[model samples]
Target: MEQSGGPRGPEGNEEARAAAHCYRHPDREANITCTRCERPICPECMISASVGFQCPECVKGGSGTGHAADANQPRTLAGGSLAADPRLVTKVLLGLNVAVFVAVMIQGDRLLDELLLFGQAATEPYGPVEGVAEGQWYRLLTSMFLHQEIWHILMNMLGLWFLGPPLEAALGRARFTGLYLLSGLAGSALTYLVAAPQQASLGASGAIFGLFGATAVLMRRMRYDMRPILVLLAINLLFTFTWSNISWEAHVGGLVAGAALAYALVHAPREKRTLVQYGAFGAMLLVVVVLCVVRTAQLTG
Candidate 1:
């Protein structure tokens, strides 16, 4: 059965947080229309922030808020639970990551040794070794899918189970995939920049963090409160800072790149969405080029 709720003072804040995650304005009186989704935004949940009366979408796309909703309307996540369908891109990525992990484990020491090139051989002096290095260049993206350990993959995959579908549905197949790849590469780029010559890092935490970053962009764009994403980001960052072996550099880098990329791609007028997309795609390519050059110089120098 479909369930709905009225604004319960501060008690319903958790609901509000979840709504904000999906780009919905949840803290409001339930009557105002969101500037992006065109759904009714509430007064409590309305974001008249940097973008004015407009909702989150306007904020992301650089649109200003213009209209106000009547006081008589309602707000709800009660609209419906988002579908849980596995996105094609999400499934493919998960599958590839798991398959590679299993292959590495099965090959025992030899295979595992060979696959872990970047985490070991990649350096500021010699760069990655040839042959496998050529193949491993793709590791910038592939590494995001690869896991440092069994539990690492499990945790990331679980997070994907919750966050991936909604994001894919909102952005559609192609853009979703693009965001994941670019965000992962961004994480890799930072790892390359910040890590010591022998410092090694692996896993999809960076890309997963990118998904979190994109979620934040969507929330602001739809005019929802940024508190939820902000809070979540904070907690995770705190964990990153405290934990051992977690590449805080990759996490921060991936998140910044993801948010930047998502803003460039997701924020724009409907009329200009296409243009924004093309521009964002170009910009992402440029970032990759920059990373490649910097990596080469660092390795050769």
Candidate 2:
């Protein structure tokens, strides 16, 4: 007698046959086996290959196994899950900014001296910026996430909520985050170079300007109408120049950084895409570091 799921075979008097079935679709009888694994697979599970049909398992087995080599293909660590949703980066950024803002509100003016990017304002004539001269470069990054007032936080976060998702999706999580942080750092670098040592500056405007520039550049690259973004940028520039106590230097620096970074990402050749993009980003950051060193020397001298 032949088993229920097994293919029919010649049987001698009272002998039993072992049942065979598809691994994936157990209910369906397997007509063919995978060429590589030799495992039984139903019609739906078959993947046509050059030599013979393969099972779905066999095809997916190459991922992260060093067997596949495609530059643009997404990589996965061993036992790691799939790529995260693109929007996750945006949400996390917004959350961190908001949380820091609340902490600033609670800490009052106490945290300002530590968090705000005050460049020379902390030096000799203006009095030393506490953490910066003490080898704390983190203040530059801290200022980007700090918002002094409720409205300041609101406007910046609103801009992030509005613009971050699409940009994140286009750039992928790592690239998008690199663009954002580098842009903000560029803003602070410009601020350190130009702002009066005694003048304090904080807020996300510079970083926000970066996103604006990125959006415009990305849109232009995609052959989409950039008029709306251009108009919006113009309006913001007007505010940046006209508004009191705003660091136009940071805004412009961030805009330039973001645009440059986005350009590298958008135009990089597919074959050397990652290498080119990261190299451009590193070069942009190196320029900022040089600017910081030069400004520090000038201030100290």
Candidate 3:
């Protein structure tokens, strides 16, 4: 082809001549060609022989690198970061939990009591008062993020930081977040159901414990030996049972919920993914509902 400025051959114009000059020195003049528009691009613009000379337009259209990543393709943890920064997300979650814990503590016992009870204890004549009653059933979800003590929040967040990343990396952020929240709700519901009707509880331990439980199950699915996980679970269970006022119900419930959620959410194909995820989520919700109903009955009866 020809252009107004000059012929469009390899060495037709000043730009082409310069490109040829560079290419000749490198003994690569034969491979320079515009990939986009096929304008016989100069060596300066030409990428290489393997991919051909991608024209400016083509490069722009290609967007940054060479091509867009497939949306469905799962991304592996890159740059050794998968392991090095494994706890990065967990750290952020930890910070949030700690901050909330402090805020609850500084607000004093009156506010702390109401905060711990959330909205469920609103009508109760004793125990912690519920702060935001009515339409705040959402607190069951939010309560997982609020802890009353430094050690309580720290322990939970640390557990999450240690345990959450591997699962998150395996499952993707969206699924991992969903499991955490849902598991926390399940944990809280179980606590409320099994404990004194007026007892108040608060902590991220339920969600963190859920992550541990889920990881244990996923590890098993991945063909890893379950000895270490079993040991850890046993230790946590022992602690729960031995510790006074630890809300063992929440711990065990969250653990089971997390395991179920992990089983449903991880390593599934697109077609069956929805079925598994929704099924697990629905089942967990059903358990929570049953617990709530049973608790309500016990209180009324």
Among all candidates shown, the one with the greatest lDDT = 2
lDDT of each: 0.61, 0.71, 0.62
Over the stretch 121-205, how does candidate 1's per-residue lDDT look in tens digits? 6433565444222435665665676665788889888767656765665566667778887887878877866676456667887
Worst 10 residues of 3 by lDDT: 72-81
Ranking by TM-score: 2, 1, 3
What is the lDDT for 190 in model 1? 75
Give candidate 1's root-mean-square deviation (CA, Å): 9.0
Tens digit of lDDT per residue, candidate 3, span 189-294?
8777667755677888788789888978776754556788789888989999998988887898899899888877754444466676777778888888777667
Question: Candidate 3: where are CA atoms >4 Å away?
Answer: 1-72, 75-89, 118-136, 267-270
TM-score of each: 0.68, 0.72, 0.65
The better candidate by lDDT, 2 or 3, is 2
lDDT-better candidate, 1 vs 2: 2
Worst 10 residues of 2 by lDDT: 71-80
